[model samples]
Target: MTGCQGELVGQEVSLYIEDNEGNVIKDEIVTTQDNGFIDLWLPRDHLYRVTIKQGDLSAESEISTFEGDNTCITDMQLL
Candidate 1:
């Protein structure tokens, strides 16, 4: 990890989709840009698991998608 103040820049984040039966339906890997943000387009109408790891610290969340679902911000902790 880049020691740029423990920022999550250029970090690989995984956005995954699993079926009700725990089968992976779709998976995506996104890297944060210089602005410490990832611009991605995810399919709507599905449930997803998003995960990101910076150094030994990590973050994960479960999200439910719907039509017109555009953006999601779970936490804000970066310079």
Candidate 2:
């Protein structure tokens, strides 16, 4: 996540993708590096509840990717 001046370097980030039933379909936990960036590969063509957490801050959103397509999510700036 980016901060006021620049990217929040070397921070812990957690990502969780859950199904409709609230069961975790894919879980990814990693530390951000080189301009607060992390990469994750998730299953395609399915609805998922995406949860992102860092420290006491967090955010959630729903998304579905096209089959066999890779997605990139930008503009996650931490206030």
Candidate 3:
């Protein structure tokens, strides 16, 4: 993911995967590197939401659903 050079440096981000019943299946926390980048691996046939928290700034991506048997990547920015 790419963002304004001054927007996402040294931030705390989190990824969460949940099922249709809203049960949390997986969760991960990551710190944005110098490039404000994060790499994620997700399981197939699951629904997920990614939340990014940077100090008092926070943002959450839309709930996404995965189809095929493959991994996916997502990028989020905290406003």
Candidate 4:
């Protein structure tokens, strides 16, 4: 839901999210939907660190949910 801006339909990946202060938010395994996306609800007005993993490949990015910030984040690339 937060990274890998490409078609990865039905792929299962590990998700790890944390606040800027190092508070853990989400850490679990999730599957991508048919649209190559996942659904997540995050608190507003804070910056977060997002990491996604699929096997040995992984991606990481920084995201925010503040007002006027982009909600749909899809720019991380799995390496």
Q: Between candidates 1 and 4, which one is better according to TM-score?
A: 4
**Backbone collisions counted per model:** 0, 0, 0, 0
Best by lDDT: 4
List the global CA lDDT of all models. Answer: 0.60, 0.70, 0.59, 0.89
Question: Listing every candidate in turn, what is its Cα RMSD in Å to the true structure after a full C-alpha superposition?
Answer: 6.6, 4.8, 4.5, 4.0
Deviation in Å, model 2, residue 25 alpha carbon: 2.4
User: Tens digits of per-residue lDDT for model 1 on 45-66?
Assistant: 7776655554565566666667
Q: How would you encode candidate 3's per-residue C-alpha lDDT over 1-79 as one tens digit per residue?
A: 7454434566766655565667776676777768656656555566665565655777776454456533433344567
Candidate 4 residue-wise lDDT, 1-79, digit = tens:
4445458889999999999999999999999998788888899999999999998999999999999999777677779
Give the 10-residue window scoring lowest on summed lDDT in candidate 3. Answer: 68-77
Question: What are the runs in model 3 whose C-alpha is more than 4 Å off?
Answer: 1-7, 14-17, 26-28, 63-75
What TM-score does structure 4 among the candidates reach? 0.88
In model 4, which range of ten residues has the least summed lDDT?
Answer: 1-10
Residues 7-33 of candidate 2 have per-residue lDDT tens digits of 667787787889766889767777876
RMSD of 3: 4.5
Better of 1 and 2 by TM-score: 2
lDDT score, residue 33, model 2?
67
Model 1 Cα shift for residue 37 (angstroms): 1.0
